[model samples]
Target: MITARYHREIPQRYRLEAGKCKKCGFIAFPHRLVCPKCKSQDFETIRLSDEGKILTFTIVRVASDKFSKQTPFAVGIVELKEGVKLTTQIADVDVDKLEIGQKVKIVFRKIQEDGKAGILCYGYKAVLI
Candidate 1:
């Protein structure tokens, strides 16, 4: 069973949908009701570009209980070609090889499972391109 919060994010998670502010040209992921840049409530729907570059990253040595089994994984803020900066798990690369400006592309993957019998949450992860 998935929580309401998770269910609400299905669109963004599965489709990489974003809302671009109609006035300021600012794009917000997860579809914010208010624009963070210019206080505008109007926006246009946009799909985020899958290709991007690693702006920054950190190797997670400690994680929450849900992700304990995936300890030491790398997470990074990737700036997509559309100029949207989003945090995502960096996958399929050695920690030593991680670096700023490394080219990456979005890949759909299982983010986590809520419980032993819970639903599997799938989302996009950044992978070296």
Candidate 2:
């Protein structure tokens, strides 16, 4: 049963979500609504591993309005062990020392704000392994 208001995003943000295309071998991270490569409507939900490697990252010196208090936080794309590349905030890390190809593991953490009245959003975030 879907438990989130944003059910479409629940698989990706709240769980170790992944997508497998029925027509091709392309796998998508963040659980696409449709396969970008094949435009396939059929997909299988896969839970990814907690481990991954840092593909790239940057420090959010100028964070968004919702993330203003979290400015200068480290964020990056991590290619998980399942080969699904995902964008997530890098936690348990010092922003100044982060580097590419660093080993990481997934953890559930406070990901973002929900305006003034909404669920305190929680999602998968990566921490140094």
- Tell me the deviation in Å of residue 48 in model 1: 0.6
- How would you encode candidate 2's per-residue C-alpha lDDT over 11-43 as one tens digit per residue? 777787787887896788766778899898888
Q: Tens digit of lDDT per residue, candidate 1, span 1-129?
A: 457878888889988999999999999987899998889999999999899999999999999989999988999999999898999999988988899999999999999988888889999999998
Error of 2 at 35 (Å): 2.8
* True lDDT of residue 127, candidate 2: 96
Clashes of 2: 0
Candidate 2 residues lying further than 4 Å off, grouped into runs, are 1-5
The 10-residue segment of model 1 with minimum total lDDT is: 1-10
Q: Which stretches in model 1 have alpha-carbon errors above 4 Å?
A: none
Pick the TM-score winner.
Answer: 1
Q: What is the C-alpha lDDT of each candidate?
A: 0.92, 0.84
